[model samples]
Structures are given as structure tokens and as C-alpha cells.
Target: MIYDLIVLLRQNPTAEVCHKSIQFLFVMNVIALAAVQAMLILRVWYLFSDQKWIQYSMILCFVACNVLSLYFTIMASQNLKLLNGTIFDLGKHGCRASRPPNFYRMFMPSLGLHTMLYALTAIRALRNRQIFSHAPVLKRLIRDGGLFFFVVFATVTFTAVGSFLTQLPRINITVIYSNYLLSLTSIAMSRIMFSIHSLASNLGSSTEWLLSNVELSRVGWRKGRNENEIIVERRCAGPDDEDYYYDDHSVLDIGGGRDDDIELAHVDGVKVRRSYDTSRSKSPMPRLTESRVGVYDDLTW
Candidate 1:
């Protein structure tokens, strides 16, 4: 009955219309496949940032799948030729083929490709979170794994339904629908990868700025507050009949001076005195007082 129905439909099947639909679907699927491959390649590259070996392994798996897919496509084409008489069946002349490469060959391989790609995406996302944070394992799993499950489940459901209910003998709706799902997945994954990359770059920039500021502050504080001994030179002409001159140099600790006299009561191991110089020729000796220097003759007494 099914074959009869198919034959009945085939009696008046519009070759032109089917041809155009197939062409449109073909173009869409090709573009979508290309997009998916590109996204996977980019994700693999991202993994190389931390795990080059893992990235290489991923690349190898992807390459192997593609190579096998290509081989199957070729084999399927040859099978069509043996069974249906031609491989390039756009319409009437090639319409008798039992199944095009799209139905069993290309489409089957797509299942594996999309699955692996999504799984890897999820793994990388989880790994990145794990490395960067100390968040609970369950939270990270729920975040990353949940997303992966949603995407994979959606793709699988759509592909299965479209494949099962499609007009298989004439049209492989699975391929069309798979292309659509893959396109969506590709877009979502690509956006996610781009966002992650941008976030990491901004974080690194912020951390670098913070470190530099800390270093600068340390240096500035050191320059502003460090204690250093400074030397002062003084030239004095002694009172004499003839010309007489003497140079006096003294070293004072810049930070050793007190802001107030009370703070200067203790000077490490040295006793406090009103003046260190006792040369009467330079100036009269100043008496020391608690409040005012040179105000008393014997204030300490």
C-alpha cells in the first residue's frame, strides 16, 4: 500500500518543483555543514590555550569522522549507480535511485558529528569554570551539562522526527531539518565561545591593571616616607684680623626630627641636648627651655 501510494504520487510528481526544493535544501545543508565545521574547529583551537594534547585529540576525531563520512558518501553514490543507474539525479533522468547519499550517508555522519561537537563544547565549558573558580561541582555540572543536554536533546528530537515522518523515497526531510538544527547549534556555540573569550580578555586586563596599581602605590609610598640622612654644608668666616674661613658639614636624619618637641624626648640611644654646636664666635649659646628655646639660662636646673 505504501509503495502504491508512492507510485501514485510519482505518476504526477512535479520534477521542476522537486528539483528546486532539493536544490534549496542542498544549498542550505551545505552552508549549515560548513558553519558547523567552522564552529567546531574554532572550539578546538580554544581548547589549545590550556590543553594542546586534548585539542589535538579532538581534531583527530573530527577529521576521522569527516574522512569516513566522505568515504561513505562516495560509496553510497556508487551504490546508487549500481542499483538505480545514475549518481547525479537532479530529476527525471536520476529519479529512480533508491536513496541518495544525503539520506543514509551524509545524514548519518552528521549525527555523530553534532553529538561529538556538542559534547566537547560542554566539556570545555565545564573545564574552564572548574579552573577559574571554586564553585561547587554540582553547580557547574548543572550549568554546563544542562545546557548540553538541552541542545543535544533538541537536535536529536528534531532530526528523529523529521527523518521518521519525512517523504523518504522522494525527500530526505531529516537532512533538511538536521541542517536547521545544526545551524542553530552552531550559532549558539559560536556566540558562547566568543562571549567566553571576551570575558577572559577583560578579566586579564583588569587583573593586570590592579597589579600595576599596587606596585605603583608601593613605590610611591617608599619614595615619600622613607627616612634618609641628608648632609648640609656651611661656610663661616671666623672673626680675626686676617682673613680666616672654615667649612662645616653636618648630617641630619630627615625623618629623625619630631613634629613636636614631646615626640623628640627619646632619640634611640642618644640623650637630648639643646644644641650640638658650642662655638661662641658663630653665635651666643642658646639656653634650652621646655616651651621656648634660648628663653632661660638654666631651665633644666
Candidate 2:
């Protein structure tokens, strides 16, 4: 921004200066928008359990949006027609870009994805609102996640709106909003990540109780007293659920919880499944002949 101000706002700005400034703005916005989407996608990813369809759909949408954004960015830059504004200058802040073609498509993917992810994140947070205040991890997910979506949504919307405004013959606020677009996206994403990490550091005291006492559908993880076990307690809510205690050593394997491991995802993407060395046990668990608990494959990353 400082570099842009120094270069483009000069009393006698050269053609070379304008060209570089325009290209640089497009490149920076493209990178910033991608960073913003990637981070938002990650946050939403954590809120789902093993719902592969939801996860896969989101991943596909993310890839498609970024690909389109990149393609449109190149197109917009090539099609960009800059007026010298002697050529009726909009002062030193910069002048209107006359779009011969689809220049506004540059930020369209960003605008669409921001709106989509914001809705998804908001819905996920709402689903967990009953435990919102109690679950520290979930609390940060909503608070930090909401703030991130709101800021990015407004920033992209502003840039998108400004691009539309530039299409009109009389409006010339494009440079000002474009400057905000490039700076705000990067700043918002990094600061939110720092806040999430800080929140994670302090959640240790509150997380212990929430882990063990809470049920499977409501709670995310439970830790055991010793390294040898990850005690996942279940207060079965369904009518069909019964007390079925499997004595097989495999049932207690700490690779997360038997076969139906409750995967714990750290806010910043570190996934953990504690390892237990069963061979070291003084009394090896007896194999069970029958059990009512349903066993399934562990949740995929």
C-alpha cells in the first residue's frame, strides 16, 4: 500500500508506473483471496464429523472457485483498460478503469465463496449453540469464525460493489476500495489465526471436563488418565443402545477409540490419536465372544 501510494500517486506518474501498479494489485488480490478461502475452508472442515459428502463437496467447491478466480484474474488484467485521466483524472488516488470485457469477474469467485462459507460456518455454529458457552473449542470456532467471515464478506463485497460502481460512467471509487481489498484480506486471515492459537493455549483447564462428561454426538474428544487408554464413555441416547462392554484388547486400543474413534482436531489442523503399547500391559485384556457395540472404520482425515 505504501509502495502503491509512493508509485501511483506521483505528480508525474509514468505509464510504466501505472501498468505495474495495476498488475500488482490484481496479483496481490488473487493471492489474498485464495489465502482467505483456504483458511475459511479449513475452519469449516473441523466442524464436520465423518460426513464425507459435506467435506468432499466443500473441497470441490474450494478448488473450483480458486481455479475460476485465477483464470478471471488473468483475463481481467489483460482486458484492463487504464485511462491516464488527463484522460479527466480522479486526482492522485487513481482513475476509472474502462472495462472492454468481463473485468468484474476477477473478484466474483471470492465474493461467492465468502458468502457460501459464511453461511456454512454460521449454520454449524448455530447447531452447536446449546453447548457454545461450555465448549471452549466450539466457542472459539463460532466467535473467531464469525468475525473472520464477517470481515472477509464485507471486504470482498465492498471490492465487488466498487468494481460494479466503476462500471458506471460517473463513479470513480475503484482505487480506494481496491486498496482496502488487497490489505484487509491478508490482515484479517493472519490475525484471526493468531487469536485462535492464543485461545487454544488457554483452553486446557476448561477442556478436560467437557471431553469426558459429554456424549459422542455433542462432544468431540475424551482423554484418559493414563497414556495406555483413551476412555471414550458413551451415554447412549437411542432406545436400541444397550450396555455392551467388550473385553477384547482391540476395543481399548488407543488409536482413537476402538473402531469408532472420536477424532480430535486442534484448531490449527494438528490431528492426534494417542498410541498405546498393549504389549506392556501387566494384565492383558481378555478377548470377548459377543458385543452389541457397532464397529466401523476410523474417521478419515
Give each model's whole-structure lDDT. 0.44, 0.60
For candidate 1, which ten residues in a row score worst on lDDT? 217-226
Error of 2 at 8 (Å): 2.5
Please report the candidate that would top lDDT against the real structure.
Answer: 2
TM-scores for candidates 1 onward, in order:
0.40, 0.60
Off by over 4 Å in 2: 1-6, 9-17, 84-101, 167-172, 175-177, 205-301
* lDDT of candidate model 2 versus the reference: 0.60
lDDT of 2 by residue, 1-301 (tens): 6765565556756666676676676676677667767878877776764567877888898888888887877776776667776655666664344553555576677788889888988888877788764455667777888887899899788666666665563333553334667567678878877776665344333222322323335434443333433333345433322243332112232323333324342222223332333454575542212232333333222
Pick the TM-score winner.
2
For model 2 the local lDDT of residue 236 reads: 42
Which pairs clash (backbone N, Cα, C closer than 3 Å) in model 1?
Answer: none
Report the lDDT tens digits of candidate 1 across residue range 41-67: 654454444577776776776677666
